[model samples]
Target: MPVRIGGLASGMDIDGIVSDLMKAERTRTDKVTQEKTLLEWTRKAYTDVNKLFAEFILRTRESFGLTDSSSGFLVNQSVRGLKWIRRATVGDVGIADVSARAGAANGANELTVTQLAANWSAASSDGISAAGQSRSNLASQFGLTDEDVVHLTISTGTGTKEQKVQITIENGMASVIKTSYGAGEDGEDSVISLLSGKDISDLSLKELTRQINRADIGVTASYEESIDRFFLQTNQTGAENTVSFSDE
Candidate 1:
């Protein structure tokens, strides 16, 4: 330690002067620290803005590419050639409605309908059960037993392009239904388990209809309680659209 001569020789306030100098130094240091913090925040803001601009540029390039086939605005290397508008008119609006794509011909075309297309449909030859009977009664009427295993195959489409869905029935309950495509396709089977673990006796006619519709088998099934018959129809109207059923 050094001996401090406070106003002994100079007779002035030396300690007060030193304290004032230290206060000035502390103020300068605090100002530098504040300036450094402001600079860091400014740098961060610029980085965030640059990131946003980069993303926007990437998306714009993808959507507006001249040669990009997936770009909706470009068609055959010409943006004006893109088909984005079309209009159609029907003579009899009540009979049918018509629509045309933008790529269709611009001139009006006359069409004559000799016969309307019909959807393939079938109904049970006889009543499945008496009127006002519960859906559970169908098991007995169809002669289904808990020990019996019934294999039901439903097919759609025509000729070589047909797709078949097979449903297995056991213990008066239907298992998962799987559909496999025909030749020239992947032949991968898609499985739908709408009736899995469900007892037929516990389901109502409406509930059964809902389950069958959700199966997406290209067929719709309905039960008419008034006529006591089950009806099945193809979901689409065309010559190629057909629905067939075979059970054993």
Candidate 2:
């Protein structure tokens, strides 16, 4: 005879009771599985965080290499490691670049970008001097009349502080002469526009230029006949080079 089972003498459903008991056990196993999945996700998050920190440390090391004079600033290897974007520098990419390195000193550095260092320039109101045509009379060539003065004052480290030089014309002529031509001449103004006490008298424009260059005033006055333009500029760059004048 086979083994007698369930609901018989007891009038109870033994199969249904055993099935419900197994389901309760299954619930416990399922809870454990979900917890294990959550733990794996947390481990992945921590791994990603550690990776970010490692990358930051690598960049910091590169920065240090650039700043250390022994390594040489902006070396190709160090700059490449820092990952400098081309956009960090201002102005034309083909012309300029910018970067930084570690420094021994600690102070706030002020970066002022006033209009790029440029020469003081002005165009003649009239086209008196044109390009390709040499004029001996710089006075008329530069649109100068009876009382126009080219006042050039040099206030820079590379020049003399007491320099209040002036270039002028008289009787439609001027030349760089070696003497107090008008420095203290009779009936002359105390400060005649003669450059460095040198008298410039009725000389051809070319000869006059040769003489002016000999003055050693740390400046050059050029007249481009092709463009019919005359310009005066100091021999330097940056804010220190302040060459002031009038377009007279």
Candidate 3:
């Protein structure tokens, strides 16, 4: 390119005119570049919208179990089917609550509750200890002797499903008496000592209750200090569930 020296011979602002022309050309080029960038952004937004529509269509087809060859997509065969909007209603909300799933039977179903189940429980008829008596002195109240061995069998369940847990007390300590059955005959009984070497005076009702609960023989034993009595109950609540205590 040849360099042109202006304003030397023309005595006019020739260099300023050429600079203004170049500025106008740069402005036009910048406008074209901005338009191109805006077009690319618009194309990208349309592509994203198309992808979302495609995903929604695929999920709808999969939900209705429709294949590519299916002519139309209708949930449960018909658009206005009652199965699509199946709902359950209870007559008395306070008594019971009901819920219905999609495609459930449309009809009034009756439910009647006759009785409620309850757990079997037994409590001492008379207070074992006097009011305000210390719980640790409960053994003395029972008149337990070192030579005396008290056997208590707690039987649960009915018929052949019956289970027995025999508790034997000696020297104020209670233990689970495990018996072995050999060929339809009663075998030797083994004693699993719970509180060994504990004297009658040293034994507490609270301690005995803890030992019985720890045994996990389907029976819960608790001593009420206020009433001064022992309460025994089965862990489950049903007619078949029973807690029978046999003192032999």
* lDDT for position 66 in model 3: 48
Better of 2 and 3 by TM-score: 3
The positional error of residue 67 in candidate 1, measured at the CA in angstroms, is 14
Worst 10 residues of 2 by lDDT: 154-163
Q: List model 1 lDDT by residue over 191-244, tens digit each.
A: 545567666556455566666676676788888876678888888887778777
Give per-residue CA lDDT, model 3, range 159-247, as digits (tens).
Answer: 33555666667766656543322213354333344555556577677777876776565678898877788998888776767666689
Between prediction 1 and prediction 2, the one with superior TM-score is 1
Query: How much is 151 displaced in model 1, in angstroms?
Result: 2.2
Judge candidate 1 at residue 225 and give its lDDT. Answer: 70
List runs of model 1 lying over 4 Å from the truth.
Answer: 1-90, 94-111, 130-135, 141-143, 158-164, 180-187, 204-206
Q: lDDT: which candidate is best?
A: 1
TM-score for all models, in order of appearance: 0.51, 0.34, 0.50
What local lDDT score does residue 71 receive in model 3, on the 0 to 100 scale?
A: 50
